[model samples]
Target: MKTFPTIETERLILRQLRPEDSVDLYNYFSKDEVTEFYDLDSFTELQQAESLIRIFNDRFITQQGIRWGITLKTEDKVIGTCGFHNWSKKHFKAEIGYELSPEYWGIGVMTEVLREVINFGYKELELNRIEAFTYPDNIKSRKLLEKSGLSEEGYLKKYYYVKQRFVDAVIFSIIKEEVTNDERSKN
Candidate 1:
């Protein structure tokens, strides 16, 4: 089995998702505003959250992907999750995804988490590139990606089928070279 590592930021801890986190998971995922652009329907049952936790663990054990629970330093409750999905070891690339509770939105929490995760992707995972996909109308998400230093790559019409309808998506990406360049400039 693959071992997962925990990450800590100034205000948050990114750790492996646990089955006991179902209640916290269900809390935010149940909100329509939070799930409006998510690929799946708004979670209606606690069991759904529990099932997702299982999937999160299975992916790490199988070495396919990872999903870290975002918990604040002052609280044990999970406020969100973020990690690499669609990982390709041979290609040294992966897609990044995340969701946060509405209560914590627009507070720079995710930005802090993402900065650490992206560094982990390039430094620890040794990835060459990371990509993100978001609905075209999700301006906040797109802006967040850009703020994180990813460039808008392209658009995909009807790129994903979600909630029984085809949705348009925009792609954003960053490469290891870009990350290195940013770091060099900062130093």
Candidate 2:
């Protein structure tokens, strides 16, 4: 099994999740707009948030997957989470997922975190391909993924059954050769 490193970016630190992060997780995830596009259940209760965080921790060692708490260095606050989830070891692939507070939207925080996490996936985990699917309406996230070097692979119709609806998804990917050490170090 591969080990997870605490990745640091320009203004962010992608660290392991902790039980203490429940409060900030509840604050951001409770916003309907924040979780609306992501695949998480509605964040209604702090207990539910804690449960999810616990599962996130459990997945790391048990499944060889990664779930990071994105903390802003300046503020020392956990504003969001990101991960390579739903992994297929035989296929050498994983689905990339992330969520951030509405306040940090469009500020490139997610992009920085994406690069760091993708590096870990490619360099450490030996993943051959990393893919992510976003709702068609989530232009901000789509743009961030593209700008961070994952290309738009396709648009899937009604790809995800989320929130009791068949939501369309836009998929993106980063192949192993693409996550070059030189390029990853710059971001």
Give one digit per residue, the lDDT tens place, for model 2 in 1-187: 5565688888998888888899889999899899878777668889978998888988988985789999988876789989988888899999989999999987888888887888788777778999998988988888888887889989999888887889898899988877675467889
Task: Per model, state how many residue pairs clash.
Answer: 0, 0
In candidate 1, what residue range of length 10 has the lowest lDDT sum? Answer: 1-10
Worst 10 residues of 2 by lDDT: 177-186
Q: Which segments of model 2 are wrong by more than 4 Å?
A: 1-4, 181-187
Report every candidate's CA lDDT.
0.93, 0.85
- For model 2, what is the alpha-carbon lDDT of residue 123? 74
Local accuracy of candidate 1 as per-residue lDDT tens digits, 1-187: 2568999999999999988999999999999988998986899999999999998888888777889999999999999999999999999999999999998999999999999999999988899999999999999999999999999999999999898899999999999999898889999
